[model samples]
Target: MQAKIKKVELRNLAFEDYKQLKNSMVESYPEMADSYWRANDIERLLGIFPEGQLVILVDGKVVGSALSLIVAEKLVDKKHNYSQIIGDYSFSTHNPQGEILYGIDVFIHPNYRGLRLGRRLYDARKELCEQLNLKAIVFAGRIPSYGQYSNKLTPTKYIEKVKSKQLHDPVLSFQLSNDFHVLRIMKNYLAGDEDSKEFAVLLEWNNIYFDESPRLINTEKNVIRLGLIQWQMRSLGNLEALFEQSEFFIDVVSGYTCDFAVFPELFIAPLMADYNHLTEAEAIRELAKHSEPIRKRFQELAISYNINIISGSMPYLENGNLYNVGFLCKRDGTSEMYTKIHVTPNEVQHWGMKGGSEIKTFDTDCGKIGIMICYDVEFPEVSRIMADEGMNILFVPFLTDTQNAYIRVKHCAQARAIENECYVAIAGCVGNLPKVNNMDIQYAQTAVFTPSDFAFPSNGIKAEATPNTEMTLIVDVDLRLLKELHEHGSVRILKDRRTDLYQIKKIEN
Candidate 1:
């Protein structure tokens, strides 16, 4: 029966119900029309069949109840006349059906209606069913009582759907509200009770989510030509002697007409150094003024040959420390300097040089470019971070001695390019310096490399210049062709790498 709309409390009976329970239930529902419990009956039930008392309260009053009982009778009756036969089942070691909880009666006081109080009562009974871990909760009720209260139906027709192992009515409604479809129905009933019309239904949750990593197209086929030249004096002691050599190398690069040119670790010489062979501060100042003339020489070379030149690095002694820097000079003489961010242990330990911390990518007449110095390129992330920032070309200038260690160091530069899908141009020391103890040692086999192979095809050299050899390697790169190969190429290695699973931070960031 329907009642007034009001808030109600839903809870299990935990206390004695005497006077108020008698007035609200016993006296009020004498005809078994409202509720069956007097207040004390609640306590007694809790004391005896404690598991059966599942109830709800409305403003501290019991408005609903779900109880259970056991009947000692034969499994089959007249109702089983047309019933289907099934296998034997029992409880304990002898029963395959195990124990069962029978939901006996569920009632709501007529005073408390319209609140869907009956459903809450049903849910409480279901909870008891689960707590007892019964194979199933079985109940018998009139189809009229149940069907008339369909929306509020206990042991609903959906119970048939559930019994037949079909979708749950309420759960299916919940599913449809959230976009889902029912698969099938399953039926399970008391073998002898087939004619009795007592049964259940089963349900399943739907599959709806996924996990995938994003994919990039092409992801390879990039080419870059990098040249590293150290301008001015070789090392510190012979600052005055290498001016001629520097001019000769500059002319060689100008004549070579390469796509890109890079000068060594400290390209501008004493131009960036605050001191000139222990000269006075005023003399050092005069030396700093010559940087413009030298830069102009590099600029003219770039313009005349139509090449992109990274005027290697210079110590821009701004503020207090010397900044390891490089300049990307276009053919138009417009130049942007990329300061080296990662300084070596020696720089911090001995030189008073500080590491730069900025990451950047810039657009150029040739393409998008990023810059790093000798020590900076050792870390893959330096290049990875630049690639992530959308750089297509990486210019790196290094200073090293002649040794196998050089090849190992050079491999990293190639890896940075191949893995990040960009062109890596590394300009390193190709000459000897007389001052610093090992400065004159020719360190590496300098070259440019790509993902599939070295920068140059197998038919040609990857433009390796000699140690102490002043020359330029000119390689014409078809930027569009490289991009095309990256997109629709046969073997796309760069795009296949799963970066999320890799530990980039673990690699000495």
Candidate 2:
């Protein structure tokens, strides 16, 4: 029969449970005679750092425990013995100001071995790391099965075999499965440990959530390079032509090592071969038919070129309702969709499209970013809400048939950057599509806008393509400067907002 763990409770280690903890540790590691910890050591550890020690109880009985201490990165700089690094189990070198959490020991009772209680203990340690914002978790893992192969293979060879799945080590395999990577093999880590042959593997679990990139306001490392394409309309030859044009720009941007590439709204209009014969509304419905293929091609291009592509906006028909949607394709072949939240009267009247209410900010390798389509940037509240959610960049893809319409998007984009203290990149469609009904004429100028501050350009324009031209404009915007402007600029608009007077609450359905 299997033992069922009923009512498992986890809390900080208390003084009364010292003897039970020692007994559990001794029973768990019966092969090692010196495995039991002294009462005075436990008392001293608890007194120094009470939060680092945790105890597990099953039915009011001590069944498991985890001990940890904080250490600076310099302590584990090079390959060294565990006893030397840990100061002979005294942990006298523990630093409260350290950025790493060093795991000393974790064990569970024999009766609770199959209950997955060890995984729970690890989960608790990870939670504590997040709460403390630690850089990573490090420990020396034992390879219990290496003792049998010690005569035939070296410690490094044994580790290589275990990593390649050619050999199975109970402890090392468990740690590897839990997202821990072995840094190196340490010799004589334990003096008399027969199971490991006195050797151990140094393992580390880096916190993926930690941001280690430089935060200098004017440094090149702080910039997010953008490639904006001002697409020119010509002929709707076929779907192949549409794909060829998109691949051309993506290749160009990737060659220049741009972080993200942006394209204009309805750039896929060339796929609608029968646009001249179909009505305005019918053409939009027809364009929606190629949404899946368009999305797939963008994802393939993003992965092949190793670049991020904003697929602009497309006419999408879902459940008998039409919407203008944009797809952000990451280099990893993953994607996120943003629907037009504020549909213009022209879109509703001409294309039979409805407005979307969902707004979101995407977290990327560069930074937090948001996507708004064309006219959506005209609304200050939309960008403000995104900025409040920690978005440092906004991408606006637009399609305007007249100069006045193009000016609306450009001016509003600049205003959004200034008002929100964020960077905005706008890409638009240009030239003429004489055969297409609704897309016959276009006027655009692709540009990257920045906040009007001392750290940015005086005109607030980082880079801009010539008006009515078909070209790709590439620019770099520093996100660190945006952070500085919000905190310590000439005019702190975002921080000086009069929130006590009015508030904008999002209504959830």
Candidate 3:
């Protein structure tokens, strides 16, 4: 039969033809006979749907038919919209935002059964959806009434077979052949056949493109060793006590055969002593005099140890302005500095500091890395920007004085790892430093955290020094594993991000 396919006009169809279609459905499956026979109710539902969804022919007769509906789902603060070809009526929610659909039903006259009209109708609807740029698409298949008459299997068994790997089943091969994967089994959806269960599969096909070309090669060694030096001062009274502990921390760090060593924020707190007692100008001079010796010692240690050191954030007076910056020192004594981008409220209001507006991802012999000072890791943008720039390791330097704050710091590091799909190594202080003028106050507790499938994992701790004790925490980092994780979806939050829907601005340095 060479009948051409066209849109269905349910309202304009002759009353006799409408009755005949309904009777055919009921006759094909007695279970839905009563519900299918209700022409007035079906018309009422059809009236609410979008026009032109139900497809049929006009050979001066009501013959072939098909239908479709647009569908969507909201995800991760974004809307992922798609379309589906549902037979007969166009289904949709009034708001088009919430989850709901109005299914349009289409029925072809028995005389056109042998023609290829259904294929043409399905293809046309699919083309219309593609033109709309829908992200997700699907189609619902109801077990046709003819399945009830087939003796090869029971209705329940037949539906199960069609829904699960029975794509070759002549009744439902069209959907499977069109690339729909079974999603789930939904029951009791058919009218008048409320007792019967209907199997439904939610198949998904993605249209997003990944075009970035990144080249990464393997080195002879798969892992890199890192050492963390968490330093703190308990009070401003005992300056000698602070230096003594620093010496011990340095000693332990020097002893380690590490590729890199990191010190926590405000690594040396001597300057705060005079700042609290004198004017800003006088305090700056005093702090400068005292911090010089400490920094000279650190540079010497980095050179002697023959290891790269990220001399975490410190109160530095460079060209008159005091900045909280991290110094990246090479084994040859050459160094680069990075100012913290995101500062806490206290640092701004009380300390008279401004946050830096730069993202610095450094290239090193081991691999590309980024450094986040304390609070910066809490913001997704910090690590996200680094990831987008191809930085695979995030070194975090934090001075967490309290236990609760330490926990928050740990969680933030883990979140960064997941968001960036990379590795994170966070070093935080663990011990106390006596006040500059006093001899007895010291605080301690330091730890290191790494990236994990769930969050950042605390795989190793070099040492959590006693309240006044000093120590170095050294651990081997698997750089190869980090790269593998980013490639595989092991810690892949970034993989699920919908970049086309959102925009990210670069933080200017």
Per TM-score, the best of the predicted structures is 2
Pairs clashing in candidate 2?
Answer: none
Q: For model 1, how does the per-residue alpha-carbon lDDT over 1-509 read when each residue is reduced to its tens digit?
A: 43453556766556653444445565434533533444454554555566566667766666666665322223322132111211121111112233444444455666665466767766566555455444344443322222323454445455555445554433234323322233233233432223223332222221111102213752332344444453323443333444455546656665654556666775444332334344333332344455455566667666766777777775556665566666676877677768788887665554556777677777765567888888888888777767766677777777766566576567887777667766666666555445332133545444555554433365223455565454454544545444544543454445555767863431333
Per candidate, the number of residue pairs that clash is: 29, 0, 39
The per-model lDDT (C-alpha) reads: 0.53, 0.86, 0.56
Stretches off by above 4 angstroms in model 2 are 1-221
TM-score of each: 0.47, 0.59, 0.51
User: Which digits, one per residue and each the tens of the lDDT, describe model 2 over residues 149-238?
Assistant: 999999999999998999999789888877688888877887788889989998998764444443546223467889999998877577
Ranking by lDDT: 2, 3, 1
lDDT of 3 by residue, 1-509 (tens): 33654543333233345655565455444545354535553454345433324445555454544433444443211322222222222333322332222223444544566565566555554444444444444434555542444455665566566657553454355556554555443343343432233433334432222112324653334477777775544553555666566556656666766778877777566546656566443554455455555566667777877777787776656666555777777777877778887888766654555677678688765678899898888888767888888787788888765667767777777767656766677766545544433212323354544555532354523234444345566777666555545544343666667788995769454
Question: What shift in Å separates residue 146 of candidate 3 from its native position after superposition?
Answer: 29
Task: Give me candidate 1's TM-score against the actual structure.
Answer: 0.47
